[model samples]
Target: MATCEPLYWRRCRSPIGWFEVGEPALIGPDAILYAMKKVQLIRDKLKTSQSRKKSYADVRRRELDFLVDDWVFLKVSPVKGVMRFGNKGNINPRYLGLYKILKRFGKVAYELELPVELAAVRPVFHISLLKKCVGDPASIVPLESVVVKDSQSYKDVPVEIQLV
Candidate 1:
């Protein structure tokens, strides 16, 4: 029990400069003033950083929300289902579907009612992946037949072949 209580704290230099820990002088008025200054400096820096981040995010972040039964189009990323989308260079659909929001899972996530054809993909999606669908018949396009081979791969049916 005596060993637990420190008779005298041995002063040691911290790896970081401009500050020292476990020193007897830390209890002095000067040390208190120094610590307060450091805290104020840190608080000011944090405030500036937070404002900068808020401005950066506000520039690009789109605030979208959906109530239950709201129709939304899910974005199709090029990285996902590469075979189904095809390796035919740059032509790839950015968004797919008019899936309905079944339930709101969280603030930024919702459970969608995807068709039976898309059973392989997850039903829950983040708000970023969804776009609030405007009822425009001209905007909707039919997807071509691209047979999925099992759960792992997809085989795109050749629409045409040309050789020069």
Candidate 2:
């Protein structure tokens, strides 16, 4: 003998329109519970699939290694006054001479010798803010290739300054 099942309905209203659920409900309470379980199973499967699709091979952490007497390009924020009038600020991406990397503090912070003019301000910077100057390229071909010979020689040379 077949038994009659209780029907369930869900109603939702939004600014744009109204949505109704459980239209033409024909399943028993046990069947409805089973369908809900199936829906949850599908959701869990989708989450696992999406997580598996993520690749971390190309994702790299930024690394900046600065040593004493190494040349580095400092990224300075534009001064307010210079930015206000649309002037290219003084610290605009210029390759300054290799300043001696005085000391390294913590993992990402460092203290360096800055030009006398900039000495009035703080000279410490995070490693992320500094880029090692690998020297200018002599020429450009189909592919961007570094002048290895020049870079190797530059790396070998050390910065020397006499202290008064």
Candidate 3:
């Protein structure tokens, strides 16, 4: 005499091994429910593994590309080059207003549609210093307007202030 261990679906990696399904009289509601839960557990595990792979792929992948005429916000660096923060880090802006991409200079550098006031600064900026912006233009808070001077020290000017 020999015993047989039934195999489930070919793709399933579940620990559960087989039972006879033809004996409907012996199959109770609890058994069906248990089978369903097991399948669902496997589904969840597969989904998690897929999600992990996607995230890992994203980690090594490049960021979003910017095309000409696309709108994006410029990232601000509080300290760089001979620029001085002068212990005024509290009021430094994390990012600047929206700028349109003018040209894809090289692989990562881009020319932006900068304001006339920022004429001194180079129009071309690296991709790392830019971020995509998707928001209403009217809602942006102009906390401190950047006053760039002579390609050296820049200033952040606030329009209003109140002690709280």
Candidate 4:
């Protein structure tokens, strides 16, 4: 009987009885201040990480500046077989148009004079989507001479052969 009474007293000191476990829950102004400080720390860390990522991205990025009336090619799609902005499939050309820039919309965007076929698409495009046209003759490929297969492979055949 004596041992049982002492054990019951010890049990009452635990959470199984009325007593709370661990540290008491913080309340009032001190608790609010601690929470706010934690939130501020998290925000600071997030900002630092985001800025670091942006710096890495900016290193590879080339600043493209286009003036009004400059000729440029617009990227049709970034990936093969993915439909984007009216262009689709690997058969389609990666870029379209030696379109002329009609106006400059801030530093990162330009308004191009699009053809009637592309009237449905927005003329304004980001600088990343536009490639400056140097008008290199070698860069131009004759469509008639090239044949693309469904597997996205092409075989080059000579149109004519001559020995000088």
Higher-scoring candidate on TM-score, 2 or 3: 3
lDDT of 2 by residue, 1-164 (tens): 10111111333232122224545545566776776675566567766865666544325555567786666766655555432221355435433334557888988888888877665668888887677867532221322232356446422334454465
Better of 2 and 4 by lDDT: 4
RMSD of 1: 12.4
Q: Candidate 3, overall lDDT?
A: 0.70
Task: Give the total clashing residue pairs for model 1.
Answer: 0
Predicted candidate 2, C-alpha RMSD? 14.4
lDDT, model 4, position 144: 62
Model 3 misplaced regions, further than 4 Å = 1-62, 80-89, 136-164
TM-score of each: 0.60, 0.38, 0.43, 0.55
Q: Which number leads on TM-score?
A: 1
Candidate 1, TM-score vs. the true structure? 0.60
Better of 1 and 2 by lDDT: 1
Q: Please name the candidate that would achieve the greatest lDDT relative to the true structure.
A: 4
lDDT of 1 by residue, 73-155 (tens): 88877776553533356677777768889999879999999888778888999999999987653445465544556787976
Return whichever of 1 and 4 wins on TM-score.
1
Candidate 3 lDDT over 36-58, as tens digits, reads: 78666766777798799999988
For residues 1-164, what per-residue lDDT tens digits would candidate 4 score against the true structure?
A: 22223334543331222336675654566666765675566567767987999999999899778899889989876675665654445356778868889999778989998989887788999999999998653456756668789999998655443455
Q: By lDDT, rank the candidates, best first.
A: 4, 1, 3, 2
For all candidates in order, the CA lDDT equals: 0.70, 0.56, 0.70, 0.72
Stretches of candidate 2 off by over 4 Å are 1-60, 79-97, 135-164
